[model samples]
Target chain A: MTMATVQTPPKISAQGVNVFYGDTHAVDNVSLDLYQDEVTALIGPSGCGKSTFLRCLNRMNDTIADCRVSGQILLDDEDIYASQIDVVQLRARVGMVFQKPNPFPKSIYDNVAYGPRIHGLADTREDLDEIVAVSLEKAGLWDEVKDRLDHLGTTLSGGQQQRLCIARAIAIDPEVILMDEPCSALDPIATAKVEALIEELKGGYAIILVTHSMQQAARISQKTAFFHLGQLIEFGDTTQIFTSPTSGRTRDYITGRLV
Target chain B: MTSLPNLKKRWGRPQVQRRLRRRYIYERIFRMLGLAAIGVAGLALATLIVSVGKNAFGGFVQTSIDVDIYLNPEDLRPSSARYRHDFAERVESADMRKLLADALERQFPDIDTDSERRRALQLFSLQARRTLRDYITATPEKIGQTVRMRLLASDDVDQVVKGNIDPRVPESDRRVKDKELAWLAALRADGRISRQLSTTFFTGGDSREPEIAGIFGAIIGSVLTLLVTLLTAFPIGTLAAIYLEEFSPQNRLTAFIEVNINNLAAVPSIVFGLLGLSLFLSILELPRSSPLVGGLTLALMTLPTIIIASRASLRAVPQGLRTAAQGLGASPMQVVFHHVVPSAMPGILTGTIIGLSRGLGETAPLLMIGMVAFVVSTPNALTDAATVLPVQIFLWADSPERAFVEKTSAAILVLLGFLLAVNALAVWLRQRFEVHIPD
Candidate 1:
């Protein structure tokens, strides 16, 4: 980590956040800071609350009937869970890409333009079109899909659909992008392409990713948080965490010994 | 517990082979039972269709005899000197029955006694008098001309022509007398008797006489009733489903409402009719036997079905899609209306159509709403007195007239045709609007 990068204030700060799904404490007390122009990877075993914590950032947990979220999550120092904050507007500034490729059952162009159209970010048809084209390009999919923009989003291959979802998240021009295992459903080649796209997108927005693959966290993220059984075990630079994890559980997880 | 090698060897054993053969035998027997069940069902349906078809064929064709009637101006003129200035009254009081009797006498000169003359006139339908009068009224210049017109045969004569009545039956046992049969034979031999499609059955309204009774009024009534049902039930049911599935919080009250809705779907349709009888007929005092009341009654019956189906389809929409839309900052209403509803529309439409089809065949509820009345005119509006096809079939099926047997069957076929058309439309709409999504 460079001294200059460490000097910048965090773009988003979670202070003592917790999530409960009905009677189950899914995400225990966890505090983390995500800086602009950096990729923060949350790595954990299955059922370790990595995805649950990722959902808390944009208040996606509000959709669950029995899931309750507590503690303050501030985006650029403004409390996101404040009663005055509109969840819809909060989500517009914080977008998400899901674990699986979930493109709307609509045309490819509409899929990419969904967010911008919903938020009224584009003033004209040409502007919306330009936004869709640029988002798709930024997701590394414009060249493959430029000619057939009207095709159904679902008709695309699994990898292309993921890219389309990423483009959808990017279309609204969010300040923070949260990804939950975005490449888990793709092949190795598609994963590489997505990883490359993430590398190019790191400096433009604060990215928080939940991944099961430690190698993926080490390769694509600047900071890494290790979660074990709904609790954050360690948080530090990705290289240091991989080389010398402070917590024994984190070291066990890094060595593929703790399931 | 066997080792792998031992298990592999066991696969080649004779006992294992016998067990495998037994399993195959069981599978074959299950397949045969399934086929037998299907064949039985198919045979039952075929028997129903064939019997109904055989009985209905006679209802579509009518026997008629061409008669040259000498329209005398003196007979048409009113004999009342007190009403000398009324031309319309002159036309209204025309002796049409006498005119038709004279025409039949002219066609058959062998009739001397009043009894024979009466039997001869019985060969023509009672409506033949009205038909002749209407013709003369429509073209008054033909009042003095000998116009040749084909007149409808009575129900007995029609049955005789269709070979439904056996000539060997005694005169005391049959409606048609031997003498009338002989006159009909003569008419047939003279090339005056013709069997043609019964346009009256498709064009005219209900009547006491089977020959002139038609289903047109009933068809219009059914259509109007179903339209009312669709218009009232679809939007209300769909919106209710959206509210329950998307917006309502998960609580005991909503759960109770859901259970009640499901129970409502299972309630007997006749119960809805009784409710309509009290609520719409007795209390509200809407027109009796009107399609408006009947449709409202059916809409009540259809609402629960549509709600259940709509909610089921809405629930079937992938949660991932909802999450995706929400992630893009779409409101709850927007998520449901734009994505969930569109994806579930085909299913909702299919359910609505199925409900409507069920409404089409419903009889008891409509009967309770006074739709069982013998309506004679085609209903022009929702408030007009009307009877639906099933009620028409019911009325015909209960008549003492033998000709009504075929009319009943024919009405059944028309009702079935309507149901088939509705279900086919449902299929077409489902296919046209279904959103294709990979699992």
Candidate 2:
């Protein structure tokens, strides 16, 4: 590798994380570093534990009654998996976007304002409206929905709803944002819009994107990691990984020979 | 194989066409059967309403006698010192029966015999004394002017006017004597008797005399009972349902409780009556025949229904909403109160109203608590001895008097009206406030 990398302390770091659902070992020992102000994409096949690991960052797996997680995840050098850590504050700091565009049954203004209002981020109506407007602008949806802020969030188109969810996640000013196949339910045109939004959102917050589209990872992500059969195979710069992957499985997956 | 020729042969087969025709015929038969079942139920309900309505209409117009009551100065201003001290004693001590008898004598001066006086007195209602007392108390100044007032007719006389006595029947078989019938006909001819609207039926209280009995007492009792039941059942049932559906861990104990609640819903309603008799009436020593005890008993009976309905509505809230709220850093309680409960509110209200209707019409539960009493005055408080509509109807239906049959049917109609009103309100609320989420 001829490129000189700028070294910095990781924004979030995982050490020997393992996840189990009842008796099934869904994710075996895996560790990785997510850098600050960079978009890191996790590319993998189905059932490859990419989504599971992404959920671990904010402890989203705790919602599942049967799920169990044992390992250490640290955000800003603070251990997130500690028993004394409040999951509500953890989720507020690290927000998530589901694969499906699941907006709440509320007006667009309220949907975006929900997180901030719940966290007491705004003290007045003007403050809440300003927060909502700014979050929507950041998600690249303000121009389209600004005139009809009172419209129901569910009435929006698929792509707009996905962007609305992104706006909702950033409304609380989360430090890290996790996205799980956000474009899987959208068409190519909408997918292009979200990919562009991700590019624009790159430097403001740490982003961990789990996607099945390799071209998505290559086009928008700066660093990429490949996972297979519950194991992290390779991690490097997106350009280097796409051109000269160090692992044979990553090569096979990139070349479409593994299928 | 000759594939093209074989396909052509199968396409043109007569047996396949015949099978398709038979299948269509069977589908028609099943559709007709389903429609027939629904039509049968609708027809039965229509028949019941029509029959009850026809019988209830007779009770709306009551037979009344416009008697000329002479206010004897001696009767109104009694000569006793106690009468001067207590005005109620003056009205009460006045011999209204003797006054009515004297009025009857003046109306028919030719009837001078002892038997004639007894038969003439029978034309007046058993409640005629109280009616005179009330009039004397209300308008004491008019007593000496000999005012004409409409008093409730006797039950037998009311039955005769309603055409239920069957004048063609033998004299011995009828409760109305020949003499009384002749007096009724003479009164009708003289324009002294008329079919006036039964305003008393709506305003007066329960009575042994069907002519004077009214549904006001029972209606008020039902309102208080349902209010108490709703106050007790709705919050407890809804909270329990939320806990069971949204917060409870799916463990053996929870499963056992769920099964037990379902089983409790199927328990006979009368068993709940017995439980109330023991727990509320006997153990707690609450006032017997009071709306409080009756309401508490019916609340226990209605709890399972409300819980089941509330849980169903809570379950109908999409799981996605819960996730969305949690992803926004809302706590577990917030996830439920902010999203799931709001979405489930309409369903819960509808279910609660339906359950309350069941409690409103319940008679057996109230019966076990001695609510089937002869309440003469309308209950003004929930703790007073009261009878609900269903219990009043039961008491009237058991009476041997022919007029009571009509009163019983009228009470049923009122009860049905109340239930329909409650259900309509529920439907209106559901449509107005229910949140519709896009799929």
Candidate 3:
């Protein structure tokens, strides 16, 4: 839309990346650029590795012992898998929200305070309190939950709990937030609320979202990436990816012809 | 109608004749026999309770004589009121019968005037006077009053009043000999030999006479055993479970350890006693019959139960919770301790309580470790030779006297009551500590 927007280096770059679960090559080599300060959506059929590629950005697949990853994943022009980089430290910079909302069995305040406490970002009780308040406010859940700060995080409704989890992740002040289908578990209203929160989140943090709903991807994301058989079939601005695509797979998927 | 039609339409064999019904007569017989066996086992439990109840309830009733023992407060009272506490301690003490004898003689010209009828004093629980004396001594100001205290007579008196004694028995065969019975009748005419319920069963200690020993010492010993068991078992069990379940690598050595744990849980508790005997008693030369050694043996037996329970609790914490913690950049150990561990606490407590209940009635193991029959002035320390409720019951059951039979039954009742109370406490704690864990 503007010359300044076209000038920024990608926040993350994936080139010929492949993911294997033992002998099963679940994700094929694919290349894409995820930019900072934008909602980049990944959508495909089930098992198309859309979520798998999102997981690769933060090295979340390292948890599964049998999962093997290949090719280069770069963050800010350097390979992220360099021997000196610790995954724990990397994860702190890149937070995650899973498909199902999993809130901790702790109070609302503690849930928000957990990330800051773990990362040693806040030293005093007052500092921790301020971080929780700010994080919850960013997630747009503070006003609804401020009165019940002592209530267990798990005791919230599905939508509130998901938002609380997002707030908990963001409290660490991560540079990029990876959300794996964060709204697939919610109703339409809750989904809209999450999309709005993502739009708001994009100003300060780069967001990589995976979703099965094509309309959802088109609605909020600035950039869109379509994956098929673990390959990045297409990547472009959301309007171009939705209305006009360079690849046949992307065209078929957008037209509801390809699974 | 369908079967008949099928038979008529059958091309090869008649359908009704070819069909095989599900039940075989032989199989039916076996099934009936199995069910019958299960029913018999279930009924046997009730039978044991009834039989044990019949024997133990006999101890709560006592034979007593309304002894009019006069007291000399000046003789017992020192310059200060401090010794007055010792007065009750002396009166309701295990040796209260002797103390009452001395006090009566101090004030009366002929206190031994009724030594002949003293044999008839068996109608009262002797523990009652010891209790009264102890109470008055605790509050020494009440020592001079001529209060008509309803002192307990004796266990033999309890049996006769409860109608447990057979009237047809000969004098030579009965502790309540014919001559003693005649003396009891004479006192009864004077309204001096009245039977009353005994609470001394809860306050006194063991002796050769069934009429004297109370469960006070055993209760203290059992409580101390539990305290020791908890102290040793809890942290050790919880740490072991956390290491095995959350941190340790999966390998043959770990698998072997896991197998051993399950096996250890099934090992006869007596083996733990024998191990304790060799290691704690014989080699270490700790005092035999100490609650310390007994507690250690029980602790060893309880550890496996607690570990298994703790592991189960840890496993019950949903994987989602751990993922949530990790996604927030929490360390793996933090994920386990901060999120998972607290949710599992209720289960751990329940398991510990159950382990305690099992340890409470463990007589065979305790006996092997020498907590069965040593006499003590008091439970002065953990290593002192002490008796527990089950051990007391075991000893009472083995005694040659018939009076002890009733004592044995009463001890059984007390042990069961302790179990009930402990279980209730566990349930209360579980409910209070319950996390947001789903059913």
Candidate 4:
């Protein structure tokens, strides 16, 4: 709350957003603000709607056949769900990394260059190469994969592929990056690498991370929101939320008693 | 009553051991049945190949008699000025059969009577005349020269040489008469009658005479028809599949369409023939008995197979790829075309090839469109009257001539070779282009 009081205008603001999959209210009314130059983590147990709420920011939930969203999610104060808004354009501005390190079955260069190529972010081959290099450099994968740029992206290890996904997301210069458990499939060493990469990438983009690990949110995120059973229990600075949660559910969850 | 010690006591009982033994027996029975099923399938396939090969061996080699005949200038008249501009016409009109009859008379000079000499001439095939005509036309300067040529023996002679017409079988029951067999023996003793590779069987068109009947024309017809089918069915089926699986909304209409497509695959191929008879031949007024109509009819029959296979393969592409593409701001169309379709391409090609191979072996459909006609000349165009390999096989199979039995088996082998090649190509394509999507 102290960090929220001193912040500039929120980069992305969700106001009473609700999501329904058929008859199930997957994401109940939840309001939160994500600020630029900071990592905000959404931490919850499984089926708590943290991932669903994260997908709503860029309308990724729209791809689901029976899923419906109500209320407003605004990026830079512009409603993303309005009919006039192009979902393609909205997604270009807000990229995503998935849980399973799903890289396109393409060469490392093409995998990083895909978003740029489709969005026409690069004017020439040289520009594209430079963009791929810089994106890989930023994702902390350039040193490992620069020589084998022509190798298929999936041939990389789990951690490297996850980093490649991050590079793919950032290649388009997306303003907001959403990660859904990007390290859950990785070993502890790979997870540590990704955590370090996130630390290095924190101030450059508004990162909204949905993670099962509360310690990951505490270690890397500047702000944290705890969700339980499709409702946000509390939101605050990372230290305050971890040490002294205002909600009883948040305290129980933090103490490993909520299950 | 159900304490831990009671459960242990029940486990030690003879009933439990009996149930375990019964389970083992059931497992053994299931495994034995599986092995028996495989053995039956293998035995059936082996029997089919062996029988077909045995029957077809006669069709691949032809019996011929080497004859040296003096080409008389009076008969050929190659020196005529009227035939100077059209030498082929002279060769065509020339009485090559008379020359063959004269050559046979020279080979069997002992046969002095007119009826015996005529019977000796009957041992040579009518193709022998064409063989002389082609050679004399190609080398017109050799007129009046004694040329040693190998000429085709009659189908009966060919059958006797190949052991299809058993000499020991009563002469009344067989096509080769005893007198003809004696002449064949004389020719064989003279080292004039010999068996060589049958070039005519591979190069010539169909004929009423099985000696000159070949599958070349049928192969051409099949190639052209399959070309048309592939060109029509592949894109249409693949695009339709992409639309249904990717773009089409999950509504009752699309569901109904899906049901129809699945049902169409099971519809008897003859039903497609009838449809082609009414639609393409009757309503569209396309040329009957032509490759064009045959191909269109087959396309109709093959569309459901291609569509069903393509849809299944398209479905096999991981949903994660689509989500990843869409998450990168790709439009719905872009998501499918860029990532999904490319990943599914190997599977689509395999399906398309399998469908085409099925169409290749299809007969009843082509039969309905009048492709069962007796076309002697090779077709020069899509609209020309042409019969496919299966229809040719069907025609030869129906003939009363004993020589045609081997020809039928040979044609079947050719068709099977084509199918095997196509399936091998499908397997190669799948291996070559399959994108490994890690789970």
Q: Best candidate, lDDT-wise?
A: 1
Model 4, chain B only, scores a TM-score of: 0.92
lDDT of 1 by residue, A1-259 (tens): 6566788889999999999999999989999989999999999899999999999999999888899999889999999999999999988999999999999999999999888887888999999999999999999999999999999999999999999999999999999999999999999999999999998999889999999888799999999999988899999999999999899999998898999
Cα RMSD for candidate 2? 2.6
Q: Which sequence of candidate numbers ranks them by lDDT, best first?
A: 1, 4, 2, 3
Overall local distance difference test of candidate 2: 0.89
> Candidate 1: RMSD over Cα atoms?
1.9
Model 1: how far residue B104 lies from native, Å: 2.2
- Residue clash pairs of candidate 1: none
RMSD of each: 1.9, 2.6, 6.8, 2.4
- Ranked by DockQ from best down, the candidates are 1, 4, 2, 3
Two-chain complex of model 2, DockQ on C-alpha atoms against the true structure: 0.69
Regions more than 4 Å wrong, model 3: A1-6, A77-80, B1-58, B68-154, B196-199, B437-439
Per residue, candidate 2 scores C-alpha lDDT tens digits across B201-302 of 899889898888899999989999999999999999999999999999999999999999999999998999999999998899999999999899999999
**TM-score result, candidate 4:** 0.95
Off by over 4 Å in 4: A1-5, B1-25, B73-93, B110-114, B140-145
What docking grade does candidate 2 earn?
Answer: medium
User: Which of the numbered candidates is closest to the native, going by highest TM-score?
Assistant: 1
